[model samples]
Target: MSSAPVVVVATFTAKPESVDTVRDACKTAIEAVHQEPGCDLYALHEADGTFVFVEQWADQDALKVHGTAPAVGALFGAIGDHLAAPPDIKFLQRVVAGDPAKGQLRA
Candidate 1:
């Protein structure tokens, strides 16, 4: 497994009637995820009915552990029914481009 730091982008679309419930559940999950080891970032963004999460982990091992974290289970249990479908999660590798200070997710 790769030991490099990783970034994750996860998107969840909430059913029209369940936006608030999804948002609240995600908020609670973010709080708990922030406390996880190797979690450099775990932020939530909402627009229309879509919720986006931008997260950074120290390494692949940490990301793997986070997949089964209790916070993740609780989040799924709380908002599974409210979601339009399964969350879309993508793991990304950053490529250097513009300014080093602003081009990537930094701690």
Candidate 2:
């Protein structure tokens, strides 16, 4: 674990027909994830009709655990075929936030 927070940006594009289902599914999943331990923030956003997850964790290790959780794994597995394309996910570290700060990302 580190002092800086871990951020995750994930995007999921839905097939036109699966948009509604995808939205509903992600909403349910995101809400559940919000209650997870070490989760600082787990929010969903819509980006050009794609579902975007903007998340913050207490640290990298926490994020790793959450990523592999049964809940998360199931959601992804269940929705894989419904997605318009493969999910786009990126792990990030804050550079300048909350009044001026800088940090680095580590694997």
Give me the candidate number with maximum lDDT: 1
Candidate 1: the clashing residue pairs are: none
Clashing pairs in 2: none
Please give the lDDT score at residue 58 for candidate 1.
Answer: 93
- Cα lDDT tens digits for candidate 1, 1-107: 78789999999999999999999999999888999999999999999999999999999999999999999999999999999989999999899999999998887
Off by over 4 Å in 1: none
Q: What is the C-alpha lDDT of each candidate?
A: 0.94, 0.80
Error of 1 at 102 (Å): 1.3
Show the lowest summed lDDT stretch of 10 residues, model 1: 1-10
How many backbone clashes can be found in candidate 2? 0
- Output the lDDT of residue 58, model 2: 84
User: What is the lDDT for 44 in model 2?
Assistant: 87
